[model samples]
Target chain A: MEQHMSEIVTAAFIVIGDEILSGRTKDKNIGHIADILTSVGVDLKEVRIVSDDEDAIIDAVNALRARYTYVFTSGGIGPTHDDITADSISKAFDLPCEHDVAAIELLRDYYKGRDIEFNEARQRMARMPKGATHIANPISIAPGFRIGNVHVMAGVPSIFRAMLDNVLPTLETGAKLISTTTPCPFGEGIISTPLGQIQKDNPEAIIGSYPKLAESGNFMTDIVVRARSEEVLERTTGAVRALVARLLTEQDTGQ
Target chain B: MEQHMSEIVTAAFIVIGDEILSGRTKDKNIGHIADILTSVGVDLKEVRIVSDDEDAIIDAVNALRARYTYVFTSGGIGPTHDDITADSISKAFDLPCEHDVAAIELLRDYYKGRDIEFNEARQRMARMPKGATHIANPISIAPGFRIGNVHVMAGVPSIFRAMLDNVLPTLETGAKLISTTTPCPFGEGIISTPLGQIQKDNPEAIIGSYPKLAESGNFMTDIVVRARSEEVLERTTGAVRALVARLLTEQDTGQ
Candidate 1:
């Protein structure tokens, strides 16, 4: 690919639920969202997991919406009394949340011949903030909503993934980042100094060193280099690989 | 157990690393910390994952430290150039970050006659904010630090766990929340209305409904009830169980 650098597209994720905070449910959405966004050239800059409290939801939604290009929230949109996400999003944007006719019709059609009743409780899924468009859920008929720059989806992993598939295509994406990882059988203490110098020499690339404990009780390090430009990423990755090779040669020669 | 309503101890977790945000590293710390805190009577109120930027780290640290009883941070306290968490923590607390004599001595002793060099980059681990106490890291000799209410630990899972083990004994705990989960072989649409009523009748208990898509393509739900009092928790869980049984009977009779 030719060297191309574009304006960065950033997004923030907000997870609203008491179950997650209480450790009753382990979150499966954050990593999935992060991976999808990165593949589509969107940088997930920040993520916040707040409780079901309305004030906490409002604060996180408002703070992230203003700071990033887009904001995505999951959970608290179900039919239970504890699900206050719609109202909180409405309050955060100063928009009134009311029942959307399209969503109501969709849910009614889905439950038409089924044993389930499209009761007032289930109709709660039809509610959305004003000036919002539906993000269709293929697995479940209840639709998620997109208001302003915020996309709200379900908490269930299958529904969340389906809704994200619907919402991603509508977002603005940037130049995808290119990265390479060089693994060394040494600790960060051995390579940290030269790694810092390599980072300075290659100013266009972002280099990170992560230390991992091996299964054999030895410490190993992985040096990752990332950049939007393929040329810079390659050059920086080469420098890291060369540094590791030099360190290995020194050890072999008893330096 | 005796019925008790003690104060609640709350905590917030902040993860500082671009690796986590970029999806290069799936976070293993949030769930582990959540389970540990809940078991120890400390409610994990919020969680934030931000990049390695200094301003971002400082903002998250300052905001979480002010609001929660304790703030636990993982990642970015290494020797590399991008590892600026220690400096950011100092800026957040407005304290001078200097090399601690004790930490330096400990590291020096650990690296004595080893293949690793106790150079400037490795010595960076000895720096801590003024008035901070060291949290011993048994996996690696480099100690994490606690400044005020924020505990800074390593990004590595083993080191983070070790540091948390060292720090947990010193913190204050509260009345543990008692919880029980009841499984229902039905979708939320069938139980939302009665669940809302049960939640209102048992106002002291916090009830949550999590719907899962089963392997056979049927929707199943788990109703969880939590409370600080054993009597309240058991009573509320019983109400939920009764509600589910009634719904199942109605379905059996074609109501």
Candidate 2:
């Protein structure tokens, strides 16, 4: 596998369903995709959860696909009357869409061994946009599809996740990640100034401060530092360590 | 609590962070809010994850807060340079934002017990928009604020979650939930026609079909039915169950 340089590879996720919009179903695809992208060094940037509205879907797809390197969509691909992802994507990209021969073949093969019927409803799963590639679904025969930069998968957590794992390895990957965190008992304000200075001093490393409220009713902050290269990250971490120690002492003696 | 008999109580979530846009962090707050809102009968209709850019934040805030009954935002309330939620909210609502006396008092009380300095950096947490009420943060002293209908919470999962729980009970809830699902071995297309009929027959119920690719490499679908009233939900579920049985028989015998 070839690795891209230290540049960041960004991705956006679009989740479609009236069930999620109505708050009837809690979406599980975002977290799963986030973790998977993180592990593979692909940054899972923005996520949009929209209803099965065609206008909303088309707008989000066009916007995100233009901004991010890759866009992944889950849900709205079923055989139901509301599964309008195929038509929406085609409309978004201005491509003709219809039931594809390969997808139908896959569905037929899977249903041949099962006690299920290969009916018109089942045939609905075979619909694909013109010139799209099918994403293999090891769990189900209704395969996900990838058109352009958008990878459309199922809404069911199990099926969506499996399809994600299959599709991720094929994408361009950045360098392995290294991260470290230091807890500061002081509030975010005390650390903000020095944190800015540290970032200014070490431009190569990516530094983030997360203010956390502990269960013990105490406010604490976590300063997370990440980098693609180990040496650069270590240098930045050293600077942060020194700054934290000095700040802690200054904070202690009322100086 | 007062119960409203509206058709739906809709909400939108705005997530503000450069980290999320850069893909450095996978957001957990959206899912947390989705689950909480669902349980409380608020329909979380849309979610927008935007970069910490001020214009983007303001634009999203204006658009979503106007359309939805409620808007909840997470992230950009820290002490760092990027912590700009309070300022943005002020701009969006055209309110003069400054450090609130009550928030300062809370911070003073919170930090008095800790061995850290209550310096300018920590003091940033006290800022709030004019006419905004503080949302309790049991996890940290840096309280989130509610301006108009927009509830601003910390981005950290634990803190955001704690703040949301505190605010949920105070909102006017619509109705408790009732839901049921029927598993169908056929694909979504076969079920779409009957699903439409079921939905039409039960206009009070929200019927949805989720396509699942089974682990046995077979396609299966879940037809979910939900309603605000248990009586209606049960009726819809019975109709769905009967429809599934009839459809399966019809497909099996090639009718």
Candidate 3:
């Protein structure tokens, strides 16, 4: 429940991977995080997909962290050569990257009795920026780190979800948006003028019109009205429905 | 064929729609475009998803277009009230959006004998930023347009694909990358130090070590070396193979 002017909590997502850009792998993380954030009332304002370059990661982290209330970065935290996100983040914030004792201990316990030796490469997963907190990954022992407003998570869909489960409880959320939809039988061209007027009238609401190309060779539009309060939502949607009816009547009468 | 030091052509994608942010519609266009661009030797450097708001879209278009060799925007070219991409793109470049005579004629021919009238809203698709050229869409009569280096396409995946097919041939491409991979029995962390040295030795080649979690719970790494020329790729990858063998032999001998 929120008032007319609830403060909005904005977030930005940075998807870091070369596999995505090279078309080797299609990303399955962005939509999952967005759906979760939307349900929790945080506005997913912007999203950026950048490759596994240290300078590129650092630049995006600095810029997005400064711009949004929360910055969520997925990927580039593995034990590989391209896993330079932690070091880049450390450079961006001018912090020292150190091996986290707790993370190292966790990895040791997980890998205990494994045939492969716990070599230097496996140990790289424990290194994080100094003064940062860990985001737990149940699927894999490679814990993601958070410094300031930036939350780092794994690129793998399963591990990222687990880390998010450990992180979502800590952040502050804004008012959840309530929405109403009015379907229009007429084409979008027939409804645009009235919809525009309704949008102008409701300055507090966000209006979006989605068109559907039906298989029956008919086109339809679904106008969605979203607002913080149910009262505003109903008022805007009511106006839209009425305007559509009026326009249809006039078109029928040849006026 | 390019030598070791070929110029890389970079591109940025801007997805303009609120549907993506709200998590109502999952975007299917980014990966499609990225795969095509990569095969043609253009680096898909960055991708940004912004809402249909004018200021947000304009800011992103200007920033991405200025930074990358080319920018492709998808969505907000329909007849609905919230379809504001054309106007925003015009404002981004400080140009006027007008109803292009050619586009209007195309629309008229397309909608001829159709059940719905070609009203103002449908005709709005013909309105693009001044000096913009059309990108043909065979699926739908509404055409995407281009201004300077920014190419605007439809949000629907099928129509967007049709428009991209028409646009890709006209753009210039860089040298197609040549790559080779060397598999390592050890983890990524074990090889990162040596890989970093290899990367330093071959500045023109990009060395990326990707780790895979084996079924036996041990992690193995695959080192991929990318360069503009086959000789550089093979040379870097050869060094990586020798380094892995030496490391393995030393560990087996308990050195």
The candidate that achieves the highest DockQ relative to the unseen native structure: 1
Per-model C-alpha RMSD:
2.6, 3.7, 3.9
Query: Best candidate per TM-score, number?
Result: 1
DockQ of 2: 0.45
Isolated chain A: TM-score per model? 0.96, 0.93, 0.92
The superposed Cα distance between candidate 2 and the true structure at residue B17, in angstroms, equals 4.1
Question: B89-173 in candidate 1: lDDT tens per residue?
Answer: 9999999999999999999888774555688888999999988999999877899999999999999999999999988888888
**lDDT of candidate 2 over B205-252, digit per residue (tens):** 878887665655445677888888878998999999988888777775
- The TM-score of predicted model 1 comes to 0.96
lDDT of 3 by residue, B110-215 (tens): 7774645777878998999889999998866789999999999999887899999999887888888767777878766567777888889999898887666666
Residue-by-residue lDDT tens digits, candidate 2, A1-255: 346976778889999997876555677777678777877888776789998889989989998999898999999887776788999999999999889999998888777766566777668778888999999988766889999999999888988988998898789977866688887775566778888889888888878887665656545677788889989899999988887888777774221
Q: What DockQ class does candidate 3 belong to?
A: acceptable
Off by over 4 Å in 2: A1-8, A21-25, A173-178, A183-190, A212-216, A228-231, A247-255, B17-28, B51-56, B94-96, B113-116, B169-178, B183-193, B211-222, B228-234, B245-255
* lDDT of residue B116 for candidate 1: 56
DockQ, in order, for the candidates? 0.60, 0.45, 0.47
Please tell me which predicted candidate would have the highest lDDT against the true structure.
1
Q: What's the TM-score of each model vs. the native?
A: 0.96, 0.85, 0.89
Candidates ranked, most accurate by lDDT first? 1, 3, 2
